[model samples]
Target: MRKLGTARPISQKQSARKEGTRSLAKHHHKSFAKKSRSYSSTTAAMAQQNLNSLLQWSTENTVAPGATQPSSDPARQPAQLDPALLAQLLGGPSDADLMRQAMTAILSPEMPQDQKMIAWDNLEQLIESIDNAMNLTPLGMWAPLVQQLDAEESGSRMMAAWCISTAVQNNVKAQEAMLATGAVEKLAGLVLGDADQGVRKKACNALSSECRNFQAGMDELVKSLPEDVWKGKAVDAAEMDSVDEVIGKLREIAARQS
Candidate 1:
């Protein structure tokens, strides 16, 4: 009878211990969830605060109508916020949303040139990542970007080409998608005829990247840059040499691929 009594107490204690452990686990889970929610709220608040600060800075620095143009000197320009800080402040936006914002800012007729430059800079930074570059087509950036290649502004043309080059470098899927937008021909035209040396240079970079190692891209690019065009165009010697260099590189790639 004593033995039975002791065994029953032991069983009860074991059950009580298990109940205590379960309660402790539930308490810890609840605490963690509450902390997670708090952290999320704090991060969201901080993001909004940073955005407001940026807007305030932009507003304060904007040039008024008929005002003197800001100095081009880097020292005289508004101090650039650190990119890492900007990324943190601008966190939580999906890749598509951020990219769309950049494209809109770039394409907006009323956006000031300096702001547009900032937008383009943001876009260039974004496409440096392979994943972001791959997302360009699905995000609907290809058409407008291709169109921007022919923008009247030399800076726009230069930056657009640079963006293309950066995005397609080492990414086969991105190269194929860019080619589908007829960007290769447009870029080739810039390389052959654009009077702006910088535009031609960036276009050459983009042209080289678009077709490298991709046979369909190579064929389209070859058709776009005929032998006659190089010999007949009145481009500067330096510009012609750059295009020739690109041609040579592409030919080498073709020889290997064949």
Candidate 2:
């Protein structure tokens, strides 16, 4: 509204100039918004990356710094294996102390059963690391803690046959070393007389090696063992059947081979 007596004249050029300025302001606002969105997204991504790196660093330094000496408290075993230490072990550390510690930890009753199983799987790895250093399992290579592998119980006896068989399969020197223990007669006896098929099956595997070795145990297995040993009723129905089936197969295979 103009004053009653006063009239202001507008020019086309000025009106166009004012409209252009308004248009420029709108474009600037949209551009600023787009740049702000991009900056925020990038900031969030970088922050996530930094957090991940810190977590990895914390675990490596605190939990299991590889090659770092474990605590002196014999009872203070690591609650969990450090991912970093596992990785290093896979990458190959030749430290005998580390290898021994890892092996001992595997069979340690203090460790969870699942961890102990994993430790068993790692034995081949330890064997590879230590093979060149000694011929047979070094004196005190394992321990007296878990002597199931050495006991006289059915399961223990079975594992003993298994261990001897494995020793033979793994190394010729191991075969000679184990055979000298006179474990072969015990294994053949199990194959013929033990009621547990697990013991029988392992005995068969052990005897297979014995036969191939031309050991006298093979004669005992072939000539002296009973024919109906396979039909003996299993004491452990659920666990024993699988091993019995295996022993039956071995008999069939041996018959065919003969």
Candidate 3:
């Protein structure tokens, strides 16, 4: 028996304490569950955002199907990237863009001659590679550089011939493309008549490269060089035998191919 609410049964006191403890525990568990759900939702959203960014980056940076080098492996998993790093990767210019800018600098009449020379210098380095040399045709670079062979400034003419020589050297496909632009005639004209010695030499180099191992190019070159001018009859006294030597070497190459 209980004494008028002053003293309770030990079992009743124990039961009340147990009920309070259970309620507190249930409330704490509910709060924890809510927090856990929120955390899960946030984590999932962040992961999805990162996945989207990576997808976008991959799409934009994917190499064309016919690229000389493979850009990615299908088996490779997407890498997690930082936001700042992703931005950087997206903001950079592509190889095509750089090439277009260089072409513009080379072909634009309003561009400074010095800048044009620098552009040719840069292109010379690039075209040393077979892929880069092959790229000249599709980019329409061959035609413009060929046209530049007739530029008023001897320096410009020299660079144009030099660029052509560098691009076509040991690159038969590039040589064929240049030949299509009718560059051999202009190049021969430079070799015979250009006042600048450097221009003449570079022009001769281009002619030699174009004609070597390519029968059509060699025929075109022979056709372009007037026999009288190259045979030492019409050349200036100061022209020495250097021009004749080049012409004779080319004739020998042509004769071998025939």
* Cα-based TM-score, every candidate: 0.56, 0.38, 0.57
Cα shift from native, residue 29, model 1 (Å)? 32
Candidate 1 C-alpha error for residue 192, in Å: 0.6
Candidate 1's C-alpha runs over 4 A off are 1-91, 229-258
Instruction: Give the Cα lDDT of each candidate.
Output: 0.68, 0.46, 0.64
Give the 10-residue window scoring lowest on summed lDDT in candidate 1.
1-10
Question: How much lDDT does candidate 3 score?
Answer: 0.64
Selected candidate, larger lDDT, 1 vs 2: 1
Off by over 4 Å in 3: 1-90, 229-258
Best by lDDT: 1
